[model samples]
Structure formats: C-alpha cells, structure tokens
Target: MSFASLLPAAVLFALSFRLAGAISAQTFAPPSKGPLVQTANYTSFSNNTLHNKHVVKGKVFDRIIQVWFENTDFATAISTPAFEQLTKQGLLLTNYNAVTHPSQPNYVSAIGGDFFGLQDDAMFHIPSNISTVVDLLEEKHISWATYQENMPENGYYGISYKAANYGNSSAKPYSYYVRKHNPLMVYDAVSQDPARLRNIRTFNDFANDVVNGTLPQWVFVTPNMVNDGHDTTIDYAASFLEYWLVPLLTDKRVNGDRTLILVTFDENETWEIQNNVFALALGGAVAKHLHGTTDDTLYTHYSSLSTVQANWCLGSLGRQDTNATVSNVFSFVAQKTGYKNVHVPANQAPQFNLSDVAPGPLNSDAYIPFAAPNLKARGAGGGPVFLRPGLNKTLTVEKLPPPVDLYSLKKAVPWQMSPRTTSGKNIIPCADSDCK
Candidate 1:
C-alpha cells in the first residue's frame, strides 16, 4: 500500500486540515505600536535581547484563571450549552488539541513547556531543577495558585477521597479530586516550598479566596472527576461548568476587564480522536470585537505557557514552549506588545508514543548550564541546587543523575516524555489493590 493509503481517511483529513491552517505567530497580531511601559525593576518577557527591557511586563494580567476539564472530545464538547455559551462571549479555538493522554503530562506541559518524559497519571514527581513557568513568574514577582475540588486540605498531597468514594474500598475509589489532575502536586518547587505549598488549596477555598478577594494573579482550578467528565459524561461536565464556573464569569473581579479565563479539556476520550479538544478563552480580558469569533489557530498545551510568557514578555525556556504556536486571542495583546511569538515546527513538540511506554534517558541535550541564570538547575532526578545567578561561574552541585558528566558542563538532559504502556492504565497502590 502507498504511504497515503496507510492512513485512515479521517486521520488523513484531520492532519491535512491542521497543515493547511499552519499560521505564523503574528498572523492574528500586527506589530505592537504601543510605547514601552516603564515600571521599577521590570523587564519585557520577550526573548530578543534587544527587545529586553528591565522585567516581565506588558498588557499581561492582573489575574489569569484557567479551568481544565477532562477527557471530552471536541465535537461532543462544543455541542454542550456551557461550552457553547462561553464561545459566544469569548474567542473560540476551533483547532486546539491536547499534547498527550491519561492527563498528567498535558498538565505538566501546560506549565513547564515540555512534558519531561511523563506519560502516565501515576504519582510521578519532577526534579525541582527541571523548572516550570512558576520559576519565570516568580522571577518577575508574579503570583499563582491552584484549587482542587475535594482536596483533603491545603497543600495535601494524597491520592483520593475515601469520603467521596462512598467507602467503596475497591481500589481506585471514584471521587471528584485526583492528584494526577492537579499538575502542581508533582513539582517540588511548589509542593516542597511551604510558602508556595499553602497556595495549593481546595476548591472550597477557591470560593473563599474569591469572596475574600484573595485570588492570586494566576489561578488554576480543577474540578472533581465527575465534574471534569472523567468518571461522568460530557453533559454532566457541562452542567458542572454551568453551575459552578458560569457564576464566576459574572463576577467583575474574575471576568473583569483585565482577567482572562481559559476553559479547555485535558484531552479527548479515546486514542482515535487525534487529541482534538474543545477550548475557550472567556473573561473580561478578551477584546469586545474578538468576542463570538472563532479562530482556527492550531494550539496545544504548550500554547498556554506560550501565551503566558508572551503576555508577560518572559523569555522562553528554549524548550518546546519556545517553539509552540500562540492562540488567536493573544493577537490583541501581541499586536500591542510587539512580543515575538514563534511557531513550533510540525511534529516537533514531542508527539505521543501511545502504543508503548518510552525507554530511559528519553531526551539528551546540547546546552548544559554553565551556571544557573535565574533558571533552576537540577542535580540528578530534579533535586534543587543553589547557584548564584549572574556569576556565570562554575560551582559545586548537589545530586546528579548517574552517567551524566556535569563537570564537562554538559547540558543535563532531563528525562523527556515517557512513552505509555500498551494498557495506559494508571495503576496506584491502594492497600492491597491496584486502584486506577
């Protein structure tokens, strides 16, 4: 059979559409005509050293709230009133897709730019040195927080809710909250820091924060499994969004003129959907003219980090996020900020190995750190190292992964995205059972 004959017609059609819509970074955004806003101790997030001002600035956010739904396909999602209603009020990304499956890595990619070899929802932890957008955000003095429904307590890092599971001791109790769905839990930078850890509060606390006016500048919210359509149906998830999230849209503080709330699913339900998922940009931050408009820009989890970095002028990690495409909604700000947004090459942003779990030392790198330049550097397996920034000098280190010659100043290749097992079942130990 010919190479063309090998692909199913549906998949071939989908790939063709994606290729046809390959747009440039500035297609939606024209050149930024606005003057640079000068603030004390601030710099532009743009990577162009020439464009570098003092700090991460621009028409960024006083607040950005993102709510992630689970496992619903695009066609089914858009048909729902809750999602459709959002499109009417905001920009719709008609060609958005998730990077991978079983959830965790997509969440990781959203913040870190690269999946770092994570392929399953297992309670996998990334080394602190691996770095997350949090590093960039905090470097610019930006604040962030995550809220999880049915989370046991503030900064609690357990697995599931026995209370919500109806005491069904059958391993893998069905509950609203799961750590795999909460991305920050795996990061030692946030989870290990007592100060940052406290910010990982429960969903109930999210409402409290909103009422108390303590909402952070960046808020990531995750609904329980039922609400996110993990164990429940898409219709239920839509209802959950309508009942819970719709109210937030009316809040001036949340959907206020400066606030941008991204509503998207983690990935599609099965392996055959090609990862297409419904995505919406709704909030006060979106321009009025852009509302009700559907932009067919192809985007993935990496785009979220791209948008954040672009909005704030935070430099890229030189990873896939540096290469990922930007969404259409950001054109308004990009047109104003003159931020350089680059398009990721096709099939380059770590495609999924879906058929099997990947092997060891997944990614090797050419650029090892001479010294940490405000970027976290990990010893082996992501242990944090305290290196003086701006010194550009060699220093003593902590634990280093075996076989890596740090002395040569060889770039530490963090474990890239792990391929998944054939089963792709997220098995966790629950007493004597494999709860999944």
Candidate 2:
C-alpha cells in the first residue's frame, strides 16, 4: 500500500495544528488502533492552490535503526576495511570515546547512559534503576533486539570460552559483550516475556526473520570475538565484515529509505585517556569525509547512548547524559531518497599511531589503567610481553619490524610518546578495578 493511502486521521489533525501554529483548544481524540505507523503530514504553506501549494513536511514516526558493532576494542587490531567503508558511507566520529575501561562498562555506558563505575567482568547483579536505551524504547513502545553472532541460547556467556555446558565454541561470542550485555538477562520483566526474550537472536536467523517480516525498530548485531578482531588477526576480522556486515548493509529492508547503522568500539586496549578508537555512523543521512575529520569532543560511551536516546525523544539517562551533554553524532537527517551505498577505500590498514588506532592511551590514567582489575604485568617493549601490575617500564616501539601485540604497548608505557608528556593527568583507569 502507498504511504499516502496509509496516512491516518492523525495526519489531518496534525496538519490543522501546523496550519494554526498551535493545536486547537478542543477535545483531541485518542489515537485509533491502526497497523500502519505514520511519519509525517503534508500541510499547504503556499497561497497558490494548484502547483504552488507549500508542502510543509512535519514529523516522522519512530524510525527503524540498527547499531552494527565491530570489534572496536582498541586494545585489539581494528577492522580497517569495515572502518573505511563505513566512514565513507556515513558519519565517522573522529572524537568518540568509551566512558569506562574494559568492555562491560563501555557496553553498560552505551546502553544505560551511565556506568555505575563497573570495572570488571565478575558478574555482579544488574541494578534495578539502571535504565537502558532498551528500557526507554520499551516505555515508548519502540522495539529493539540484540542479534549475537555465535551466542547459543541467545545471551549465553561461558564461565570460560571453552565451557562444555554452553556447547561448542562459536564465532559470535567475541563480537558481542556477553559479560556486560548479560544485564538484559537479569531484567525480569523483559526476560520472562517471550516476545522480548525471543527478540534476542542469532545472525543466521536474521534473514529469515526479515523474510518472515519480524525485523524490530532497532537491532544490535555483534559478531564473535575472533571475527570482531578481538582475539584474531585483522585480516580475519575484515573477512568477517565482508561476509556478515556487508550483506546486511545491502539488504533492502534494513538499508535505504530511512535506516541507520552505527558501528563502534567498546574501548581501546590501553586504559588511557584518549579518543582514538572512534566510531563510524553509516547508512541514511550521513555525510562522507567525515572520515579523516576528527570531532575532538570529550565524549564517552554515554554520549553515544545519549544520542540514540535523544533521537527517539526518550529523555536522559541520569547525570551523565543530561539535556546539554549528549553527543550530537546523529545530527544529520536524510534529505534525499534511494541508497547512497558506502564505498570502501582501496588502501587497507591506514597507518595510524596508538591514539588513531584506539580511543585512548594505554594505562596512563590511574583509574582505568592501574585501577582496572585486568592489568597484565608490564613486559619489555618487545613481542607478546606481559605487564605485572605496578611495574614501571617503557618499551620503545619501532615502526614495523615484528608485529607485537598492541595491547602490550598500551599497557607498558602508557605515557604519551612522540608528543609524550610527563604530566600524569592523561592516564585513564579500567572500570571497577583498583587504581593507585
């Protein structure tokens, strides 16, 4: 059916308001039960009745949105191909930063709009007042889902990645923050409801669900750790994106018209104060070469969550995301129709310093760096080194001889190097962990 044909009486009512600049002082009837969701109304603004009638575009209904996550954890190798392609297609947040250290707190900050200072993956009970983006969406009747890559029972997290109780190891677990996202499991109201629970699905199930016509308004797709570039090589991560993310970008129902896909990292390998591992916002209403132009805003994960919350007019998530502080990443609105597909840059692994690679510097910050519970022992600036907590050491990294683990570099000498500074203020702490 045509959109015009599906326009509800509310359009006419809204048109009246638009015409007068104020709603009529009358008994406005409640919305009727209708299947079609309304986006806007056409109101005449010009005096010419024939062709000159001004068509005043008003509001659009809740838009269908998706946040496709890549292994943005800065500590690990990043997905370069995906980054180039996505940035050209949409908005690249050159200044995006994760609020807390480690994966769980960043995820929590992204969803909940504030991290309650969580620093580890020890599985503490989710707080009742910990309002999430999902919670706000639910209050407004907007639907959302998290589609994991290889999570077996939808939200499964093995005690170890090799736990037999959870069955064989899968490819999706690494991509999704299983430890942090587990709060969705604790929300009794959502967990008990089959409709909400069923929304949590696997990536393979997405196409059928779309064909079966069950796509939600918002989707969070996380690939496994290996594919997300967390534990595996960058080349493997690029292949995963080529196979999984690219297909979804090309889907008719998921892309074009008025859809958005946000790709971001949880945090960097180093628990330092930086904004390098930024996010890319692609699909619908984004501008290109937003790629190299970094937005030097002091934003964290809460900012991203706040942006989503504001887009839906869902309000704030506490002191962290008050009306004034939310990140304005989703500022662009779609002006044209049809698909403006993203073009991936031919060059791969765009050379970058530690800051360009991840969101922040390594453990320079006492909070996330030394304070974070997972700090490995400081190793020599050489290959596959370990950092014992409190070991003060510096490893001079040569540009490309042996590909040492980036995480080790971030951990060992977190102090700024080339433009290195002696000031200790640049250090960032790992969330929920002890700091000196």
Candidate 3:
C-alpha cells in the first residue's frame, strides 16, 4: 500500500484544505441578500441562461467579475459619496485609464484586446474570423457570461431598446440600452454562435443565476445608460451602486468564493484629460490586508483581458493583451504569476485622450485589412497564443504591408461599411453572413 493511503480521513481533508488555500489565498463568508425580486419580462424574447458551477482553479483568483460604469472622469467619480465609501472596502486602482475617448471602442477593446481602430459609439459588426477573450477562456473550459442591464432580451441585436413607459420626461422615449455598450455583441465571433448568444444575458438572468448559486467563473456587467452615468451624472451612477452593488458586496452568492470584482468606467467624460477613470478592486479574492489600500499600477482597459489571462493561465488574443506597456497584468495577479509590469513615469505616460487618431481595419479614411495574430507574441498567461481559423498565418499584424486605399478595398470587401450612414443611421447594412 502507498504511504499516502495510510493517512486519516481528517488528515487528508486538512491537507486538501491547505492545498486549496495555497491556490485561493482567501475565502469569505459574505452575508446573504435575502431573496431578490425578478421584474423584467422575458417572455417576448429568448432568455437562455446557462448555469454552470464549473470551477477553473487559477493561480491568484478563481473568478473575475467586471462592473463597468461610463464616461465619469477620475476626479468626479472619486468625489462622489457612494464611490468614496466603496473605496474604503476595496483596493483603489489609482492610475488606471481607458484606451480612448467615446464609449464603444473602450468596451470593445476590453474584451477583444483591440478596438480595430474604431473611434465612435456607432454600431459595428466585426467579422467572425476575429476571435475574442471568449475563445481563450473557452479553450480552458472557464465559464463566462455578460450581464447587461435593460437589455431587452438575450442577444438582442437591435441598435437600442427604449423602455415602454420609463424616461426622465414622458415626452420622449428613453433608450436605456444601446448595442454599442454591449461589447461582445459587436463581434460576430460571439454574436453568431447561438449558444454564445444565449449567454449574453439581462439583469434578470443575473439575479436568477446568483440566487440559484450558478454564477460562472467570469462575468462582465454593464448597467443601463442612466445608471452608468452615460446620460446622467456621476451622482446617479453612484446612487445605483449604492442600491445595487452595496448590498451585493456582502451577498455570498455574488461576492464570495475567491471572486474578484472590478468596478471601473469605460472612459472618462473629459476627452481633454488623459482618460483617467476611477477603478476599484473588491470582493473575496482581494486579501483582507489589501482592502482600503491603493495600487498605482499603470493599467488600461486591456488589463482586464490580460489579468484574466494571467489568473486562469489562459492564452493571449495576441492583440493589445500582448502589449507589455499598456496591458500590464493586475499588480496582485502579476505578483503571483511573476509577470513583470512596465513602469511608465507619469511624464512619459501615453496620452489616451485622443480618438480616431490611429488607423486600422475599421477606419474608413485609413483602412488596413484584418491581419492575423502574432503567433510569436506571448501574453502574461504564458500559454500558446490563439490563432483564429481562416486567418492567413503569413499575414501577421507586424508583417502586414502598407495600408491600402479605403475606396479600393471597399470594392473588394462589400461589407466594409462605416458604422454610420450619412443620414445618421447607426445600423450598417448586413451585407454578409458575418453581420446579423
């Protein structure tokens, strides 16, 4: 008989506990939020919610939940009372910034690691040949989902959804949900898959998942326009946090089990500034010792992707996630993973305030065809980079030839239309199977 087989049951349990503790540094017995009320009507549209308790052990944390606000500058958000109060319970990220001005590109870049040079909040449909963090997460069998508030239905493709009777004034219809804010939907890689579309859920689904104790390993939460401060003030967004996030902070269903919750904004309202936005790291995964502390790592929206990649030891999208300067892993995760982060002196920090300056496949004025991932570039995860199918392996982003004329490329690629039409229509016509 093996020597290990002779151990007592209690001793084996203790040994297992120690090993688990080594993987997840901390655990919490958070208070429960009594039963939550489900108010949204889900009968009209498909509301397929996948309930998976599959736990993918990570080097630092098990699960990551991102809660994003909108367009509030750092100074304004930090000054808000509710925002200030939450900082006391979490780690405040001091130097975090958004990638660009306007909301859509930042949201897109957060998941896909690149915005493809998008500069506006107009509706865009990326080709299915492009892959996202979803592909990387799935490669490791890590469950992930996006919970959007006021999203009329699961994977609803409409440009926006206006509530029937809800608005500041009764005179105008209020569009609380916009497709631009739903990051994953912009990519055909996610939206085209029926199973993936089902995972794009509404707030009601989030409540149900929490109550049922079936929350996934990775989640992205986006509040509605008013609640996110896009069409309102930071005070309004703070109030929503108080009413929604404050109680949930202690709710074991939402915040426990080594789950790291990141509360951040998509971009700052002041385009003239450096796009610095207030961000906080909270939940059980954060060590109690680090609570109420501040981390001054130079992080951007792409850090979210890289941080997740590092946590789960997942592969890179080979986009900005591999950019050492901009997409540094979270300091806490980097410490555990031995990922060296670049330190940018404040004077030398890249100005992220400019929009529509860089050119890529999405920019009509300076169009470049979609290029494949850099197979040689490695991310914080240290896993083999993911190369999407149908991509020309020889046409890597680094080796791509000079930019082509927009008009000339448009003739060959009929689906390459600007996000907006001259008449202010946000919908780009569905020209191919890639577009919905």
Q: Which candidate has the top score in TM-score? A: 3
Each model's TM-score, in the order given?
0.70, 0.55, 0.85
lDDT of 3 by residue, 1-436 (tens): 3223544676456545533543321122111232244563322332445768878899888888999998777766776678877887889998999998678889999988898877665567888888899999999999989988778888898777876434322445557778888999988889999988988988878878887778889999998877787766666677778777888888887888588999999988667668999899999988888887888889999999999988888899888899999999889889998899999899989899987566677755456778887778899999978977887888777776676545344432223343332122233554432222
- Top-lDDT candidate index: 3
lDDT of 2: 0.42
Rank the candidate models, highest lDDT first: 3, 1, 2
**Model 3 TM-score on a 0 to 1 scale:** 0.85
lDDT of 1 by residue, 1-436 (tens): 2223544677556655543653422111111111121111111121111111122233655578889998776766675556776678888876677876667778877876656545455455655555677776776677778877667677777655533243233435445467778888877767888877877876555555555556677779887766677766666677677667776788774567788888999888657646778888888778878888876556777777667766765655545565434322255555665544445455553444252242222222222222222234211112232222233333322222333332145332343222222134432233412234
RMSD of 1: 13.4
